[model samples]
Target: MDRVDLLPPPADAVAHRADAYAAAPLLNSLLREVAERLPEPGDRPVYRLPGGRLLRVRGERRPAEPEVRTAGGWRRVNHTELVKLVAEELTRHTGLSNHDLPAEMLDSRDAVAALLAARDRATAPGDPYLRSEQCLVTGHPHHPAPKARGGGPVAAWLPYAPEAHARFPLVLLGLREDAVVEEGDTAALDALGDAPPGYRLLPAHPWQLDLVSCAAAFEDGRLIRLGTTPFDVWPTAAIRTVYAPANDLFLKFSLDVRITNDIRRLWRHDLLKLRRTDEAVASAFAASPGGAVWLSDRGYRTAGFAFEELAVLVRDGLRDHVRPGATPLLAAALVEGFEGSPLDTLEDPAAWWEAYLRAVVPPVLAAFADHGVVLEAHLQNTLVAVTDDGMPVQALFRDAEGVKLLADVPRAQGWERLVYCLVVNHLWEIAAALAERRPGFEPWPAARRELARHDLPEIRALLTSPTLPGKTNLLLRWTGADGAAARYLPLPNPLAGA
Candidate 1:
């Protein structure tokens, strides 16, 4: 059977020291079988190929290639080509080839080395989410070692309660034997304190971890300490979840896997848009005196998974708890427009944008300047919280990975998904909001140019800014609105000439 054995423990494998993982004999055998099939069995193989496992056979007939559909499109590469690629990659990783090894193993040696390297990384220290554990946390400290305290026996604990999960039971750190600590466990408690700032602890539910395995008790039992395990919730891509762990702290998780390539792509595209948004908002804040600030993120993590989690929790959170037809900002906007339709009719195009911009836009721009960071500014990436009186009180921004500096433009040589998201998805949402307020909004092209000017000065200077392409035209309304003939009054850009 054609297969790949992914997890196997070597003589000095790192997993041997980790508490969560054990050896995978089945995987080891699978890898060896695949290695035995190599055409030239005596050659030494290189290792740690980037894309996938590959090895070239001097005389063995190549297998048929499989066509796989990816985001970019369908891509197909036969086993022979893949093997050569892997062989080259192996050389890149180990800097050794078959000639470097003894002649006795020439045909088989190289393939074995390549497979071992791939398996090693697949089972390495930082790679805890291998096939063995789809969503598992590693127990290794990623910090400076604390001085060994020979005080009374104590245990380390990290308690996590999912507020959105019906206040799910908390996960407590305990000992390997699951022994309960009576008194000296204070040190562990001191380290874990209640919760991080801007976050609060929630009451634990019955299902959560009742107790945690502590290092103190483990050390007393002469056991090696496993490091801190970061508690996380996993979800598939395509879903945005709303998560409330405890203490009314709300978080959004996108269901996407983060990879080095993905990070580079986003850095290339979205980074500049964010930078432009920051500068434009900076100008806006300089103009408005009473304007509040919008919170924007500065760093970007591929929020693919976080988005998924956020979607699920959001739907669930609002299903039974959120009040119907009681949007705080819209309700207040109704009070502002005494002659307009009721707040529920906010779906009306012109009225909606007016309400959105007046109530939401100013502060968001101000926040961009205040933080000296650009916000993706997309609808789902943002939160508008209201006070008891239904006024837009807090604009919460999350997903730092999508945030970037105006000065740090990524090379277009990478991917443009990041740019597509910020310039296309995020700006589109705002444009829609603006269009709903002003039907004649049509400055998307100019606005697009302005955005490039503000955020991507480098790129804009290099090439003419692309024409703004979208169904809605927001910039036209803001910039070209006729003062006397316009039904809605447009806010003049304070930095228009400059």
Candidate 2:
């Protein structure tokens, strides 16, 4: 957990590091989603594939340096070989062959290599919050291809990548008054730049502009290209979302590229339902205990002709919602590790973790129990604000597009989604990271105490359940399932025994 100042690794070393970074999540998915665990005596635990091939890895949290048993004895597999092995095993396991996912796995590894090279040359943001937002090099630890930038050329996406510490100005555009379709409060868009008469000011992500075709609209006088914004915005872990400090605003845009499970676009259906979901979550936060806040997605603006591709959502910034004198950091980045992470220098791990639970656990549970609002309270969507002493004080949650209400879905289904996001994805990763830094620290007991205090009907079953729902991102993508439609496999529940 000690901070170190070391020179960047050489090109070959960088490639190796990238392979390790990219392989961890893919291995986690393969082990969790398909491979069956086999009893082994050595330090490395072995898994039996559907084809009866035995595989073993070096670590548990971020499994690495994979090796498979063959006629020549144990043979090491690099990221590329690992991808091939996974593909063949998945085919045997699912009775379906997928050619695209293997390519994406390779692309994800190559993207990591490019990010590592760019990060070595670029300067990280001075602000700790921005640092947390941009520090996710190994993103979505349960995903097979978290960093695949739609298999685009490195040159096309590198300049906009958050992992590269890249920041740039927004490309301003003018949607002709008659062609503009807007909902909610979008006054912030006009403040970014000015548009000529008969046009409404709209802001577009520059990378998205490259991916989407807006030339026809521009030529037909439906859309006009205004100059770029005067200020630069920093891309957050959600690559399409950017933070404008001067305006104190967060802008979520529709990018044509598929980053994780689906194409990262602001779909028309989700946008239409955004207000209801955001309002329900915002109300839930208002009624909950403690200092938890909901960073509201106020509104959106887009061209009617290209609704999904051109939509830009305006989200509440940190200034208003975050507790005063506290710096907010992305929850996922804490697990990933950053230069200014409190996990590295905390004096008391137990106290720090207790404070984290108090700040994060209550609102999420209360929202689901009392208000029937299921928030996507995963690591990426939640931010923990810490005091100067590195003690967590408050939690802020965002992304209305991911929110679901009980009216829309059955209660059991909503609870499952909440448990997956809140416990499995958010708390479990933080516990693992904290335990990795401080060996002997048991995080589950305190987590159990926190949940036991809640009076929800589901709490009893949650604490006693032998397994928790773990999303199958690998199988979901391989089978071409809709990203929003989540499928879960059972994972051993630590809370059950705590």
lDDT of each: 0.28, 0.93
Worst 10 residues of 2 by lDDT: 1-10
Model 1's TM-score against the true structure: 0.30
Q: Candidate 1: misplaced stretches above 4 Å?
A: 1-167, 174-246, 250-344, 363-371, 386-394, 406-423, 430-498
* Global CA lDDT computed for model 2: 0.93
Please tell me which predicted candidate would have the highest lDDT against the true structure. 2
Per-residue lDDT tens digits of candidate 1, residues 141-252?
A: 1100001111111121111111011112222222222222111112222222344333222212111112222244335642222233234332111112223322222222
Could you give candidate 2's per-residue lDDT for residues 201-270 as a string of tens digits? 9999988999888888989999988999999999999999999999999999999888899889999999
- Each prediction's total of clashing residue pairs, residues at least 3 apart in sequence or on different chains, is 75, 0
| Residue 311 in model 2: lDDT | 98
